[model samples]
Target: MAKYLVEASYLSKGINGLMKEGGTRRREAVDELFASLGGRVEAFYFVLGDRDVIVIGELPDNTSAAALALKVNASGVTTCKTTVLLTPQEIDNAVMKSGTYRPPGFDEPYEVENWEGEGGHLAED
Candidate 1:
């Protein structure tokens, strides 16, 4: 299972619904939605500021997460931003792997005479 952090902002219609249905009802509805997708909600909170709600949960995979975002956004009630969560072990595993990558301008000639550009110069070994 993949964990996700979902931040949502409710639109006018969604706010109206929330006002009528209340917070617990909305959370229950969200829990039901996740269950239907074979996922589970770990935490849900109503917050202030830019986002109206925050949800932390685990879904089957990225596809399931995208599907949830698409369906909710399509409803015009709320807009969702989903972020995939990675554990510390996952980061450690990733760092253990090796890869060769050449950034742009890597092999290009640098005008040392006019090296007044940003980022300074590369040190010589």
Candidate 2:
């Protein structure tokens, strides 16, 4: 499963709704949303800032996360921003992967021309 950082900002109407239902109920509703999507809500917070809520959760994949965000956004109550979070191990693994990508109209791999390499000059230009 992939983790996500969900930043949600409630509109005026949503804030009024929250005032009526209360924070605990709002959090419970979020939990139910996550449960219905085959995921779990790790943390849900209502804070004072540009964003009203911050949620950390894990879903099966990016598609699942997007689906949840879109559904909530369509409701017109809150605007959500979903960010995919990567683990340290995932970053380490990615750093070790093969790199064969090249810029357009280029032949060899791209690298700093004047930057010194570990052992010394590593540029071919």
* Candidate 1 clashing pairs, residues 3+ apart or interchain: none
Clashing pairs in 2: none
Please report the candidate that would top lDDT against the real structure: 2
Candidate 2 C-alpha lDDT tens digits along 19-101:
99999999999999988888999999998988999999989988899899999999999999999999999999996876665
TM-score of model 1 (CA atoms): 0.85
| Backbone clash count, each prediction separately | 0, 0
Global CA lDDT of candidate 2, please? Answer: 0.89
- Local distance difference test scores for all models: 0.88, 0.89
Off by over 4 Å in 2: 103-107, 111-125
TM-score of every candidate: 0.85, 0.84
Predicted model with the maximum TM-score: 1
Looking at candidate 1, the ten consecutive residues that score lowest on lDDT are 108-117
